[model samples]
Target: MQRGLSRSSSLPATSELGDALRACRGAFLGVGLMSCMINLLYLTGSFFMLEVYDRVLPSRSVPTLIGLIILAGGLYIAQGVLDLLRGRILVRIGTSLDEAMSARVFQTVVRLPLQSGGRGEGVLPLRDLDNIRSFLSGAGPSALFDLPWLPLYLAICFAFHAMLGLTALVGAVLLVLLTVLTEFMTRSPARQASGLAAQRSELAIASRRNAEVVVAMGMAGRLTRRWAGANASYLAGNQRTSDVAGGLGAVAKVMRMMLQSAVLGVGAYLVIHQEATAGIIIAGSILSARALAPVDLAIANWKGFVAARQSWHRLNGLLRAMPAPTSPMQLQNPSQKLAVENLSVAPPGEPRVTVSEISFVLQAGQGLGIIGPSGSGKSSLLRALVGVWRPVRGHVRLDAAALDQWSSDDLGRHIGYLPQDVELFAGSIAQNICRFDPEAKSDGVIAAARQAGVHELIVTMRDGYDTEIGEHGGVLSAGQAQRIALARALYGDPFLIVLDEPNSNLDTEGDEALTRAVRVARARGAIVIVVAHRPIGIEGVDMLLVLKDGRMQAFGPKETVLAQVLQRPAAAPIKIVSDGGVSKP
Candidate 1:
């Protein structure tokens, strides 16, 4: 939900489809030449078979006939071998295309305007990539090969008899039109079904991911209903698409049967009139069938072609929408003297600002605590400070420079942040701590771990610092995970530290230890900001700010706020709650 890399800039328009096909000149020429060779092989084999049928006279030479048979066999084998080689080449092309497209997609995502990133990360492109897979692998190349076959089959028919060939050619054209019409009828419905399926998958993924939360909240029945609804909608869309496509198929079948019947009747009349021979009739039938090959392929792959086109367009759109970053601000010393002037932030997916007109500052070697009730804008304030969500009205500055003016890399290098929920990769304990700076060495990693209060716990593990944690640090206890995340934040010696609910799940001892680490961060000249309703050992902070209903209720030194709390017995319990929530026996 944070303002990710700035999205102020756009990518070039021409970058959408990738470089033009002409730019890949060699690949296009290779594909075209290979297709021609394949068609030539097929035509040669067809003619060779036709010769055998024509020379059925009893006076034919046996040796010459056998030689012709051998020649035909060779052409068949050559065609098959070339096809095998071409298939391998197609695989390479498809893989290259996927890699190239994915690279562009990622680059565009990184470059896209920050506002569009969240919405753009949805399902269509991946589905489209799947479509691209089918196309580049077989469908696209087959369509290319069909281009040559259509003309060749027509030419062969013309050679036998101009009128008969013309009739077949007209039928071929009609078949193409029918195929296209059928595809058009199904295209919208198929796209709708595909979109519904994508949404269902996203729901399923989100549900699976929050399995623990669902179980804890006992929302199993609700989740099941939601999933069922998505699936039902998806199935309904799919059925509609299938029905339309099926109807088109039925129509095409009737047309094909009627056309073939007419062709046979015409051939019979020509033969009786002594205008054509039996062999010519048979050859014409074969040509007609050959001409239908591409038509059939096109009809069969309608869904795939539509999916691929949509995927291409979606990916192109995302890439084109990526935003460019602004120029980096010049910070002479780059120390953290964080300040917020009339800060405001609206929660994601909602229009209302949760924290409005809130302002505070934290200088080097100082710490500030933000305390508030649930939904009282405590977390929103930290998010604003960290540059996650931009304020609707005000501004945030670090060392007198606007947050927007800093480069993303520079901001990341200087500011360390830990969200309420921590995420860790699958790696050794040391690796997770030194995520960005891998060359930090064992000593540097261990020192940071010590500062975060996890060094001793790590040594107790079988692998010591080398212990491998599962996904998102699943192997560690919650407290251990928190400390490890703290170590990650402390790894690069950042200038400012933003901790969101760091002590929410920690026990009393863990809370005290975390507080000590925050103090250590302050000693390192970091401007430390802690957001928590329950302070958990923040008594020694330089300042305390209370937020309620999106406005600052109190802001000043801890003593002054503590005195205000004591004056009102109703609010006086905050100190005890702030001190690690310890209960009296």
Candidate 2:
């Protein structure tokens, strides 16, 4: 079921990712300070080379040489500690990002299918979030942080010699151009790869879900061929992106190395001409390499950078499309009635309305049966009634308050639903029946099971209530899963129970048990709406609605609607069955 979409309003425009990062901004500031210190300390080797060559070797002073070595070693250690600390801070920032937004990301994943009307579309948001966090924590971010200090190293190179500075500056420009080229060349292919990957993943998931059909019908080879074609497209796109990034990264590395050698050769000429000391050669080479190191690292990690950037944009768009909903007030548990006014609902993520202009009112203790042909929207109506699909044009009111006026968490507690396809989480039978309530009482679980008339079947198992149900209740038969789902719907004795094709898989015994459950629900003032094709499935509903082509054809008390649709005589009597007797309505 779609959770929290019915919340009355959306929040104001804001970047959720930015907001999450801001919560961790203090640590970021601290990391920046450390980067500043670390970059300054990077100058140690250059200066030590300058000092040792220009002073110590010429003077032949052992004490001075030893002191310089000790000082330089200490500075190197400090830089290493600070660098390590900065990396740790980046990791923590990633952790902070996850801690702040993982829940929101998961919530969006759940709600995404409701908007897109597809199961696999939701898988990307969580993956996007992971991509962002991984980039932040990895060496990619450190390369970014180190980039700003490039000019500092360039200035120092100029102080050593003008030619050395010119060499380093030209290398920086070339590397920057190469980085830009990599980005432009790979962007389109990267985007195409991501789309193809999602498509391939969705197909694989769908094929696996219907694996039984594939194996039973001998169509495994056909699916495999289709899947292989999609995989080939994805691989081609991915390969193109990697080729651009990888080739440019190699160029950047070679250019940086060439720039370092050119600076050294320039320093050698300057010293030979007696315009610079011998130490200038080593110092200039080291400084020029340091200046271009960040650019080199960035080019090497360009693919990761692009992936992170795209993920950021996708996350931004998703958050904008489904802005965080404002928390609605807790409304009273709906008791007296359930009303749908001028309602028209399309399938989730669909544009054409499938159930149109539906208006109805069901009083407390009344049970409604929705009957129609396969294409007549009986199941769609039930979905809307339980707040799964948002109506394009109407209100689903509970008591006097609209459904949107209640928080989904609170509203969920008051409404129970069983969809046409039964799904059971992997857990013990007791957990499935109690809807996984942490504080569920065993008595309530037993009561719900007994009400569904599945208690006898459940207790026959070796572990009984404690028996584990595998994913999708893989160990249970079709009839057993349906019965357990019914028990779940009746778990809390919710004010309204919406069931779609409640007995589509049931045997005769199961059908009789379902009728008793509906009777028990109405006896306790809980409204029941069952969408069913079989007449036996409507056994206890007080009201009946017939539909054709998404529009209502007839609606009223069960017998009256039946008689009118069947063209019965006006004088004919209709028998309405209660627990053990019949009455005239």
lDDT of 1: 0.71
- What is the overall TM-score of model 1 with all chains considered together? 0.84
Which candidate comes out best when scored by TM-score?
Answer: 2
lDDT of 1 by residue, 133-159 (tens): 566677645664565578778888788
Q: List residue ranges in candidate 1 displaced over 4 A.
A: 1-13, 20-25, 55-59, 103-124, 216-218, 246-269, 324-333, 436-440, 564-585
Q: For candidate 2, list the clashing residue pairs, or say none.
A: none
How do all models score by TM-score?
0.84, 0.93
RMSD in angstroms between candidate 1 and the native structure over all alpha carbons: 6.8
Given candidate 2, what's the lDDT at residue 93? 90
Model 1 residue 134 lDDT score: 62
On residues 1-585, what C-alpha lDDT tens digit does candidate 2 reach at each position? 000111101223347877787787788888889989998999999999999999999999999999999999999999999999999989889888888889988888888877778753657988988988888898987887889999999998888878888888998899989988987898889899999999999889889888899999999999999999999999999999999899998888889888888888889899889989999899989988988898889889888877877787787678888877678877777899998898898987678889988877889999999887788898888878888778899999999788878777788888879899999999999999999999999999999999999999999998999999999899899899999999999998899999899899999999999999999999999999998888999998989987778887666788877766577565664333333343443
Who wins the lDDT comparison?
2
